[model samples]
Target: MQTNVYNIAFAESTKQVYLHFWGCNIKCKGCVCQKVVYDFMLDRNMHLHLAEPRGLAAAPERFMAFNDVIDTLVGLEAKWVLFEGQEASLDPQMPFIAEALHRHLGTTNVLLTNAFVMPDLRHFDKVAVGLKAFNENLHREYTGESNRTILENFPRIFHSGVPMMAETVLIPGYIDYQEIEQIAKFIASVDKNIRYQIDAYFKAGNNPWRRPTADEVDRAVEAASKHLNNVYAYKGSEPREFGVKSIFPTEAELDAAELAPAVESRHLVYA
Candidate 1:
């Protein structure tokens, strides 16, 4: 099966496989994919110092083969396979891939998506929705898409019997603590025990928003905690406990990779 998977990384300590798909449904102003596509945890300092966006430096020429993907996962002995980067939900083969890996390797399949287009939750063990903003106008202004479907799908997926979590980037001026509290309240309404994570947005391209300070992230988490029972903060700049090694396209291949023209057409544009 041909797949949009471009980059894959394995973290020995965590026993997790990071499966990165190429295209996205909505274009966010400060999308981390535009800055760095590979595991930022591999070299946090270099990624942190990047002033300009690298665009699609990690884009692959074509989709990967299903057999190759399965073989690689089997070899790595991955306990968890996280479908992320750009948007894994955009790939039509995601459900099949998740099912295949679970059946053949028994790897816990997790998907990190923007929740604009809901995937078949039956195949996934857990789904983490990247809820950008609770306010419709702000969400559209930031991501160039409406949050209507995303908000509707959140509860729909959660009620599907699949484990679910919600996360949002804490863009200081654009999506601050106030916005986070609203998102948390929404999630709490569905189920307050659901895990909610607030990630500190990093600078990307010419986006006017600045990165939130550690203290600012803490305040956002505090606000979210008021509504949700489980809330956490993630500062991407911080060092990770374990190092991740590139599994599919090695560091050399990623360095020499170029975005295919056809791939741009795959990016979903909201009508």
Candidate 2:
């Protein structure tokens, strides 16, 4: 089977592997992918400031094979696998990958999705949904897609028996604290105990929005706390407790890499 996974990073101290998929159904205006290609934690320097868009970072020409993916995970001795990047749920082989990881390596599987497409949840140990905005118009304006399905999917995924959490980015002028409260209330309606995380929006692309101040993030968290029992805020640039290394398309390979330009291919999903 084919997989959308293009990049992989491993944290040795944490025994966790991050699987970055290549495509997204909805395009967000301030997507971090437009700036940095890999997770910040995986960066050797762990730069606090967002790097300018460097195009596709070491991405392969084609999607990886199922056996190749499994072998790499097994070699990493991964205890956990996080399916992230543009969108994990968009990958048709996600369920199979999660199941194989659990069955063969006994690894915990976590999915970080935009909540645009709901995938089979039975194989996943945890799910983190990105709740962009609660207001329909605002959500559509920011993500370039209607959030009706995302709104509907959140509740369904919560009731699916797998542990779940919700998160949103705090764009200073746009998706502010008031908007966060609406999202929190919506999640609370399903279950007040569901964990909600507020993230500071880092500057990316030519987007006019700026990163929220620590005070702004705190206010958004405070607002969200009113409806949800568990609310936390993240600056998105926290220092990593462990070291991370690129597993797939290693630094050497990427140095010699001759792939398509990021503008033309970063968002493309090969089947």
Candidate 3:
């Protein structure tokens, strides 16, 4: 089977590679991925433009056989692989894909999802679920979906023995400190040991929300820590620095990279 994987990169923290699958079931209002993915799609050469200056490297969007993906990861010496982007569970063959990664390469798999449609997490080593809000109405307003299924799936995944973590964007006044406190309390009620990370929401594209101040972020983390044993916050605007190498000589070279034709195509899955 072939998948519309548009991007791939390595994460230093996890010492793993990520394959960004194309599709998401929810429309989160302030998602920055829209700018990242579409910018590249509009000008297949854009990733190269950004990659060169930042010393970041990535491959163009393409379709690859499942076995080919496993081989590539093996070549990269990838021990962990994160399946994300728009909601990886939307891929019908995800379970099979996860199994293949493990069976062939002994690579551990992790999934980043909205948790709307629960998947069999038996093969996954970890799962990070984005909880938009603890209040149902706010969740529906922000993500255009109810939080019922997402919240229910959290405990299920945690109880399944696969590690689980919950993350929410600190969207300034919108999903602010009050909301995080409630979210932390809710997670604590289920299992205090579950990891929680508050991601900083930064202005991107036409998103109106402003990024939280360092002081605000610190307070949010402190509040969440009260309810859970392990709590962290990701200040996206200030990502931990890392070194990367280019696989292509230039934008033209990147744009010229060979891409296998997709046997099946899906619609744009996210904003």
For this target, which candidate reaches the highest TM-score against the unseen true structure?
2
Can you write out model 3's per-residue Cα lDDT over 202-260, one digit (the tens) per residue? 55445567778878999999999989999998774443345332211223443443242
Segments in model 2 whose C-alpha atoms lie over 4 Å from true places:
52-62, 255-271
For model 3, name the residue pairs that clash: none
**Residue range 15-111, candidate 2, lDDT tens digits:** 9999999889998888866655655556552563554443333334656888899999998889999999898888888889999999999999999
* lDDT value for model 2: 0.82
Model 1, CA-based lDDT: 0.80
Give a tens-digit lDDT track for model 1, residues 1-271. Answer: 7888987888888899989898988989878665666655554224453364433333345557878888888888889999997898888888888988888888899999988987877778999999999999999988899999999999998999899998998989789999999999999999999999988887775677777888999999999999999998887665557788776767565544423233543421100
- Model 2, TM vs. native: 0.90
RMSD of every candidate to native, in Å, equals 4.7, 3.7, 6.6
Off by over 4 Å in 3: 11-15, 38-61, 237-241, 244-271
Q: What C-alpha lDDT do the candidate models reach, one value each?
A: 0.80, 0.82, 0.71
Give me candidate 3's TM-score against the actual structure.
Answer: 0.80
Candidate 2: which pairs clash? none
